[model samples]
Target chain A: MVDRIPILKMGKYLLLSIQVDMHDQLALDLQEDLTEQIVRHRAKGVLIDISSLEIVDSFIGRMLSHIANVSRILDAKVIVVGMQPAVAITLVELGLSLEGIATALNIEKGMRWLENSVNEDEIAGEPESDEDTDAPSETGN
Target chain B: MTKTQTLPLKQETDIVIIRQRVRKAAEEARLGLVSQTKIVTAASEIARNALIYGGGGQCLIELANRDGRAAVRLVIADQGPGIADIERALVDGYTSGSGLGLGLSGSRRLVDEFDLKSQPGAGTTVELWKWK
Candidate 1:
């Protein structure tokens, strides 16, 4: 059986940290799984941490773009984080600019960006509602 | 021009193996971080093309000297329905398959030397070389 990259649910967001050098099929599987998870959980944001990936070829680059695109259609914002400097240079040299995908330097920054974007969307989506003006409800008991 | 290793490009998982072997060879050649990454990424794109487009093939990793500088060379060959229009195939966003069509043109940009040979009924061979 092929190993799968696990997806964690954090409130209204889904987080996936790819910790392995994923084969092609594995990458496709992650895309399918994440899309399903987003719909099932009604996730508003997604964070894909690729810090462990040493290389990002055209196939993987396309996969990332596909994931971001699909997530956006499902109303979830996607943030890719922790790309190595060398990988960034190589992707550009390889002609894969990875356009349309939002990126951050690290997981912390990615989460913050996702949170802010989702919050901004909520605010923009409900400008006329006074009850939703204060802040998003905290996940507290 | 001593050949270091030869790997089969029959399956998708083999692409990962090819990337690992190429990376090791690049490190052995003492290439810097960015160059190593570039060569490895180039190897990956060409190797996949061999597997997907050229059907199934083999890759030979060779450690060579380019003007006395250490260099790593990868020769990926496949015996499948070969490409007839090499010029059009080299164009960016010109894929016969469902890829983003950056495999050939992008690989050429990443390496110091790129050579492609293909015969319609014979096969396709891509030679990628990067020097330290």
Candidate 2:
């Protein structure tokens, strides 16, 4: 029902901003859009800013973890930033960890970090660009 | 925006429209992405609880004040069996139903403010708040 979830483009990267009133469907939609964007743009990395968000359930935390997995497949790194203290605690209780994913102070900091990483490394360790991260390869999604 | 209001109960499908409306409000207000995500996450969980547990309820999203600062107050209320045991339900891995049981307790961890009220078959009401 969210007519359209806004897609904010930051250079080759995309900023997916979502404000959902319900917790379940919102998580589903976000997961869908993020996966599509990762492939559509072949983005180098993704930053999911959750500052204004009010709640995050186990499903979302799991979805985010899944996003990181697929992102790695698409050759992109994902950083979840601006997590509210409460959301942080919930994820902790659920024992949800971002693993190798990075989190920044805020969206601005996230962008700055990515920019610097790209500039300094000359895009070193570029993740092999694959349009579909969900597709089952000889490996996995 | 400062008014304290209670919304009418609706269904899970209604959440999609609510999500879009909230997202639009956030964008127009220039809350940025971080704010948007946080809002969406909390809203979705609370709304779903109302539909699933409350036997259908209303969603209330208001611009309220917490200690005199701008804040987002979200509430999903249902007149279903109120939570009989709040403490037990809060414990991680404690589930009375077949679901993961993270819906209430897990969501409690997801938002800045979480409040729940349940009294047997009477009903249940939950309140969650997140600020800039």
TM-score, candidate 1, is 0.92
- Chain A only: list TM-scores of all candidates: 0.87, 0.75
Give the candidate number with the greatest lDDT: 1
Quality of candidate 2's docking, in CAPRI categories?
Answer: acceptable
lDDT tens string, model 1, B1-132? Answer: 235789999999998988989988998899999999999999999999999988889999988889999999999999998999999999999999999999999999999999999999999999999999
For every candidate, the chain B TM-score is 0.97, 0.80
Question: What is the DockQ of the complex in model 2?
Answer: 0.23
Best model number under DockQ:
1
Candidate no. 2 TM-score: 0.54
